[model samples]
Target chain A: MIQFKQATKRYGPTLALDNITITLPENKIIGLFGPNGAGKSTLLKAAAGLVRLSSGNVTVAGKAPRQMRAHLAYLPEQNTLPFAWTIKRAAEFYRAFFADWDEDRYQKQLVMLNLREDMKFGHISKGQLAKARLLLTLARQAHCLLLDEPFSGIDIIARGEITRALVYDYSEGQQTMIISTHEIDEIENLVEHVVFIDSGRAAVFGDADELRCQEGKSIVTIMKEAFRHGSEQVEHV
Target chain B: MDFDATRPIYLQIIDLHKRALMTGELKPRDKILSQRDFAQRYNVNPNTVQRAYREMEALGLVETLRGQGTFIAATEEMLDTMKQDMARSILDSFVQEMKILGFSLQQALELAQEAWQEEESRL
Candidate 1:
């Protein structure tokens, strides 16, 4: 379980994450949802130990994130990989780096994602780049997988492929996945829980089906209503 | 496996299986897909599928054997009860819709009969 005890982050004068206190459960596919610049990335970065919290603390499985780095695999929003390296080269790099990296899963996902081993990172299309990044990230046997905007700026087909890969790779009750995205409808059915963050505050957080059942609306619709009328109507879960 | 956003998805999964049983697509002893496979097939959370399977078991619609897997457990009597229950719910909504359209009971029944005959003729 990942617990953010009154977690707060600041970048100079901007408050990226405001006193956000929430406990994300383990072994479930969680949706970290919000609009652009709503501290979704910051929250994910904090969990991945990439960003330091200005105040409060974030812990993974009752330990600091940095201590749990080996068990966490983080996929940033942008492609941070070397542009000159081929997909095969990147796989080799990951294989040499992470002890838990699964080559068998990598080979299978490489084919499943329709990505050629010889394709250079810079030369491939946007869709392929997204697939390549996802392929590498999922190949790791990490306990907690943090994906930031996995579907952003990609075509519908690529988005579908990514979703398929996530579902295919997901093993119930063994892995914890936190997927952050603004596109709620795309993953409405894919996630078991949702945390709606707006302006760096957790507006609403609850089980997806329970929220749907309680509000008599879809998660997308609930988000729309929550953000449309401010956070007054929302009762934090 | 498209789901209604407003309702619980687990309930919908149960309804889908019940529908298959009603339509004879699933028989009394037919084995169903494992929860993991069902989740992957439907592109949904496995926990949701597990909940659906538990609900099905509670309803006596399916049973899981040790070291084996889940199978359709509805007997003839259970199937009859299921059919009546499902048909009643559908009919309730249809009647409610007709009433909202300002149709009287007699008129609604007549229109329903006509619609049923039209559907049968098409089939």
Candidate 2:
């Protein structure tokens, strides 16, 4: 399980994540949803220990992400790759860096995702590159997977296919996945829980089924009605 | 299918259940779509489908046994009740929209007749 205990982060005048207190259950898939500038990326980075927090903390499996770095896999929103690296070379780099890098999985995913080995990072289509990035993330045998906007530029069909593949292939009982994205419909069926954020605060967080029952709408519809009924719109969720 | 946006989505789900039941499209003892299949087909959240199924079960329009798939409620009484419940649920919403459009009894009747004729012509 991952626990965020009043987790707060401040960057000069900006408070990215403010007083977030929640427990994310283990062995389940979670969707982190919000509009733009809602601190979805910041919170994921904080959880991965890629950035420093001004106050409070997050613990994964009873330890901080920095302390449990080896068991965590974080895919940043930005495409992070050596500009000059070939696909095969990048695969080799991942192989050497992570102890649990599965060579068989890496090869299988590369073929399954239809990636070309000779192609450079800059040479592939943006969609293929995104798939490659996700393939690399899944290739790691991590306990927690944090994917920021995995379907940012993909089509609807691919989004569903990718999500289904992730669940069918990578969802070992010990694994936990938290996907942060704005395209809610594509992945709404895949997640067991949901955490909605706006203006750096949690708007709603709980079991997805319970929220649907209470609000009498899908999360997307709830968001729409909430905005239509109010003018202020979420200065703080 | 997307909810029409003017009303709560759960209400639409209830109406869908009734229409399916009444038309014999979804028969009693027939396995209903799984939550995932329902969500994927409609491009909606599985959570929403789960709640819809739960509420349907509570209202006696559907039932689920352990390890068995969910099934539509059987018997003529169950279908009648579902239709009645759906009609009552949407009356206030229809009235409110009609009032907002300044539709009086006679004017609303005229509009309904025209629209119904237009729809029939289309068919």
Candidate 3:
């Protein structure tokens, strides 16, 4: 479980995360939804230990994020891999770096995503690069997986394939996945829980089904209403 | 499976299974997919599938055996009850819609009969 206790982050004068307090349960797929610059990436980065919280603290499984770094797999929005390196080279580097790296799963996902080991990061299409990044991230048997905009800039067919890969490769009841994306409709059914952050605050957070049942609306609709109304803060727990 | 965004997804999942049972696609004593497998197949969360299975168990529509798997536990009597319950709900909504459309009971029944026949001929 990841718990943020009145977390706050500031970049000079801007408040990226404003007193955010949320406890994300373990082994559940969580959808992080918000408008651009709503601190979605900052929240994810805090969980991944890439960003330091100016106030309060964020912990994973009762420990600090930095201490749990080995058990966490974070996929940033943009590609961070070297352009000259081939997929095979990146895979080898990851395998050597992370002890939890599963080469078998990596190989399987490579074929499933229609990616080749010999494809260079610079030579592959944008969709293929996205898939390759996702493949590498998912290859790790991390306890907590943080994905930021996994479907950004990808085509519809590629997005479908990425969604399929997520469903097929999900570790049931053992892995906690926090996916931050603008594509709420694509993951409406896939996410068990949802957190809508607006103005760096959790405007709404609850079980997806319960939220749907209460509002009689889809996640996307709920998100739109939440942001439109300006953070009414409908929290289930 | 296309889901209605207005309702709870787990309830929809349960309704889908019930419809399959009514159509004989799922028979009594037939094994059902595991929650994880069903989740993966439908691209839904496993927790949602688990909730649907629990609800089905409460309704006596399915049973889970330890070390084994879930199976259709509905007997003929249970199936009859389910069919009647489903038909009544569908008819209730149909009648409510017709009423909202300013149709009298007699006219609504006649329209429903005509629509049923038209559908049968199309099939």
Question: For chain B alone, what TM-score does every candidate structure achieve against the true structure?
Answer: 0.88, 0.64, 0.88
Output the better candidate (1/2) by TM-score: 1
Going through the candidates in order, their DockQ values are: 0.69, 0.08, 0.61
After best superposition, candidate 2 residue A3: deviation in angstroms?
1.2
Total clashing pairs for each candidate: 0, 0, 0
TM-score of each: 0.91, 0.66, 0.90
Residue B8, model 3, lDDT: 84
Error of 3 at A145 (Å): 0.7
Ranking of models by TM-score? 1, 3, 2
Best by TM-score: 1
Tens-place lDDT per residue, model 1, B1-123, is: 589988888899998988898899999989999998897787787878888999999989999998799999999999999889888999899888988999999999898899999999999
Q: Choose the strongest candidate by DockQ.
A: 1
Please state the Cα-based DockQ of model 2 relative to the true two-chain complex: 0.08
Candidate 3 is graded, for docking, as medium
As a whole number from 0 to 100, the lDDT of residue A77 in candidate 3 is 97
Candidate lDDT (C-alpha), each: 0.90, 0.76, 0.91
TM-score of chain A of each: 0.98, 0.91, 0.97
Model 2 ranges with Cα > 4 A deviation: A225-237, B1-123
Model 2 chain A is weakest, by summed lDDT over 10 consecutive residues, at A228-237
- Using DockQ as the measure, name the better of candidate 1 and candidate 2: 1
